[model samples]
Target: MAFWIFLPITLSAVSLIGCWTVYGLALRFNHICSLRNWEYSNSCLTNKTVTGGCCTEYNIPTISGSGTQFPENSLFSATINAASFLFVIFSIFHYAHILKKCTVHRFFSKSAMVFGCLAGVGAFVAGNCNPGELMFLHYLGSALSFVCICFYTVLLTFLTSTCILTGLERFLYPVRIVFSIVQVTLTILYCIFFTQKDFYYRHISAIFEWTLSMNLELFELSYAVEFYFFSSSMLSVLLSNRDEENTMILS
Candidate 1:
């Protein structure tokens, strides 16, 4: 049904808007330094104080850093968790679509499904494990999510180019290929910059992170075209295990 297309659309829109809203709130509440003057000036980042009266110096605002404070932190967590849930659904639907549209490339489809699900799990962990409180766990989750997502996109793009899931493969193939390349490139750059100590490098890393996320959202949005031809029955068949059903009935 055409209405099913809204799933990917909503996932992309909510993720983009929710993360930006959290960033805006972070700026408003002085949770992180502004991008306009993204610098540590006289060891004072903002006039406002959440804990003590003291103002703390900070680097350029990354999404995680921006959501480390009150109010905004709550929103950030909610947004990430919501996106994560949608991601899992999207993965399942894509898998079902592949199953319905093509009988070949079963290995690629299965690998993509596994990686996509792992990415969702990592997103969930990253959302719940606050970077400020649980730095190690949060970083671990973020790393897993990024790496898995990169793999997922590559495999999905390959499948799109090879499979006839959508008659629009001629268009989606090239587009997804470009998105996959950019995603991998930016992921690498973000990791490199993330390890730097200089302010400029750190700030550039934040920019890369933001760009990486937006690219991913756009990539997901492109799947709305596929969803336009989707049916809920596809997912049902994908989930139902005939052997398990037979075993249960016999028992």
Candidate 2:
């Protein structure tokens, strides 16, 4: 039970760190590529030329091309795809373990299971969605991934709040509350700004055109929330032990 909480946290931390590293590398590559009027190949770093193969005159790299050279954003996107898929696997394993223990509330356990399934589905859908294309299927997959993250965020927030309110522990309530608020806010904003047709086509595309490509921020935030939740849970266990010790001494 104790280990289960740590698993998600550990995985999320690793993912977040990996994402940051990828982002940095991508940025650096973009800088170098800009000087050479070169851009990263979409999908992978193959050396072949495809449609939209070159860096735009404006210095922005295209998403698809030969795999020989990768732009920073392309590399970041690939890393995110890989890390997110791995995290989904860890989430499923952690949820399954918790389900076996059944120490948490029935609702929490069931919710975790559902969220785990959704995350897996999201990963699958997103994997199939091409980053370089603006097709409906691509957007649909992205939307599904966002939805899965939102659902999981809500369930985790609810479970954390329940733990706080039920007097499970005291010292970690602040952390849990902050974690819940951030995740809820991110989820709501994502639905409104990224997922909705009005915002996606009208606002995002009109203004930034590449708004979806910048979803790295959301990914980082999601991982941050997961890490905090795991840390708070582990801290709660420690606080519980201290409380028991005090109670025993007082009695």
Top lDDT: which candidate number?
1
Root mean square deviation (Cα) for candidate 2: 11.1
Model 1, position 150, has a per-residue lDDT of 100
lDDT of 2 by residue, 97-132 (tens): 343333567567456557756665664455445445
Cα-lDDT of candidate 1: 0.86
For model 1 the local lDDT of residue 55 reads: 30
Give the candidate number with the greatest TM-score.
1
After superposition, candidate 1 runs with Cα above 4 Å error: 41-59, 240-251
User: Where does candidate 2 clash, by residue pair?
Assistant: 26-72, 40-71, 42-63, 42-64, 42-65, 45-67, 45-68, 46-66, 46-67, 46-68
> In model 2, where do residues sit more than 4 Å from their true spots?
1-6, 31-78, 100-104, 161-168, 194-251
